[model samples]
Target: MCVVTAAREGQQAGCLVGFASQCSLRPPRFVVWLSKANRTYRVALGAPFLGVHLLRRDQHELARLFGGESGDDVDKFARTPWRPGPGGVPLLTDACAWLVGKVERRADWGDHVGFHLTPVEACADPLPRGPLLCLSDVAHLAPGHPG
Candidate 1:
């Protein structure tokens, strides 16, 4: 699982994303699918960049905050530690690894929209504390936006 963040026109949004992966090696590309029902998706539509943050196995609470809560009602950034990244996107401070990606393209795919990204900046902890947070670790979470 990952937390995806974006900012546009003074608004910032983020949410827990389950559908994301490295889609290319050469030129280094990545793709993240955001549910149309999500507030992050709405904000991302106008944003030029996105911050993708990888979580650690022990970051269940962080996942819960992003995954189970709606951005419509809460300011996720205010609840967590983050800083302005490239393109003014919010970058989660507690991520085990993270990347700031330029939005290369947007593809509408049914109930979700896929954002193709080219990495602009990235970081990784030199000594990872633990394994990555996986879907199973967050299976019990109730999505902020349910289809």
Candidate 2:
């Protein structure tokens, strides 16, 4: 699982994502699918960049915050430690690994939209704190928005 963040104008939004992966190796491309019903998706539609944060196995609370709480009624950033990244996107400080990517393209795929990305900046802990948080780790979380 990952948390994807975006900013457009002065508005920022983020959400937990279960559908994301590296789709290319040569040009180093990645793809993250955001539910059309999510507030983060709405903000991302106009954002030029995105911050993808890989969660640590121990960060269940963080996952719950992003995955189970709706941005429509909550300020996730005020509850977490983060900094403005490239293009003013929020970058989670507690991530085991993270990257800021330029939005290359977007495609409609049923209930979700796929954002194709090209990495612009990235960081990884030299000694990871734990294994990556996986889908099973967050399976109990109810989505912040309708699917």
Candidate 3:
């Protein structure tokens, strides 16, 4: 699992993203799919940059905070420390690794919207410890939205 965050018009949004991966090696492209029913997708539509965060196993609480809540009704970034990246995307300081990407395209994929982004900037500091968060760990988690 991964966490995707974006900022637009003074609002910040993030969610636990499971349907995301590198799709093109030639162009260094990455894609994160967000449900159409999700609030994040709506905010991301107008965002110039989107941030992808790798969560360490011990950071399950971070995942829960993003995955379990919707930004429409809550300020997910309020309690977190973050700064704007290249395109003004909110990047979390506690992530194992994070990347700021320009949204190259958005495609409708059934109930989810696929956000394909090209990495504009990236940072990696070797994770000191703990495994990356996995899908199984959040199987029982519920999204803040009814969607």
- State the lDDT of candidate 2 residue by residue for 100-134, as single tens digits: 99999999999999999999999988898878999
Q: Tell me the spans in candidate 1 whose CA falls farther than 4 Å from its real position.
A: none
What tens digits encode model 3's per-residue C-alpha lDDT throughout 1-147? Answer: 988988888777889989999999998999999888877888899998899999887887788889888787778888678888876788899998998889999999899999999999888766467788899989889987875
Over 4 Å off in model 2, which ranges? none
lDDT score for residue 108 of model 1: 95
Ranking according to lDDT, highest score first: 1, 2, 3
Candidate 2's TM-score reads: 0.98
TM-score of each: 0.98, 0.98, 0.95
Query: For each candidate, how many residue pairs have backbone atoms clashing (under 3 Å)?
Result: 0, 0, 0
**Tens digit of per-residue lDDT, candidate 1, span 28-116:** 99999999999999999999999999999899989999999999999889999999999999999999899999999999999999999
Most lDDT-accurate candidate: 1
lDDT of 3: 0.87
Pairs of colliding residues, candidate 2: none
lDDT for model 1 comes to 0.95
